[model samples]
Target: MNTTKLNPPTQKNRLITMILAMFLGIFGIDRFYLGKWKSGIAKGLTLGGLGIWWFIDGALLLMDAFLHSLGKDSGFVKDARGQDLRLGLSMYRLKDGRLQRDWFSS
Candidate 1:
């Protein structure tokens, strides 16, 4: 059985990510800034999926930020390390092999 190791949330700046996505998302700058190099390259190669991906990413970030501001668990996007950008949900399999829900990250 494989276990998922949970790490604390990363301190990456959401605002900076938003700015990068807004201005240079076509180049995958936002993914690069989040340390997601593989997706970054893919995004770059696809030209942000002909701009659709770019727009979706921006919208997701906006939604994530909006939900976070409401003091809710809202982790629509995570960094390369598999940690949420903010307090959000996590999933894990317990030792007994049951799926467990970790409602928030610190």
Candidate 2:
């Protein structure tokens, strides 16, 4: 059996979250940002799990926007400047950028 402990995904960035969901989100980009690793990859290749979950997938992103508007600021992360940063949620870039991983995610 896998030893990974399943923790609730972390939320990150409002605008960036919306953009990711708006564009690459259909392929699980948003979930990946929220730290839902398995779901991200699956949704990415399966096109929101065969497109049947299109609404549900979109809801995930909408919920983030809704929550942010309510000042539920958990998604905002701190940057090197010690200010709340609106960073995009991405595992990789399509071009001219680097990919990153969260070693502690699992």
Top candidate, metric lDDT: 1
- Candidate 1 wrong stretches, greater than 4 Å: 1-10, 86-106
TM-score of 1: 0.69
Q: What would the per-residue lDDT of candidate 2 be over residues 47-105, giving only the tens digit for each residue?
A: 97767555565665566444434444343333223333232233322222433332222
Error of 2 at 29 (Å): 1.6
* Model 1 residue 54 lDDT score: 99
Candidate 1 C-alpha error for residue 21, in Å:
0.6
User: What 10-residue stretch in candidate 2 is worst by lDDT?
Assistant: 87-96
Best by TM-score: 1
lDDT (0 to 1) per candidate: 0.73, 0.53
The alpha-carbon lDDT assigned to residue 22 of candidate 2 equals 68
Candidate 2: lDDT over CA atoms?
0.53
Candidate 1 structure quality by residue, lDDT tens digits, 30-76: 99999999999999999999999999999988777665555544368
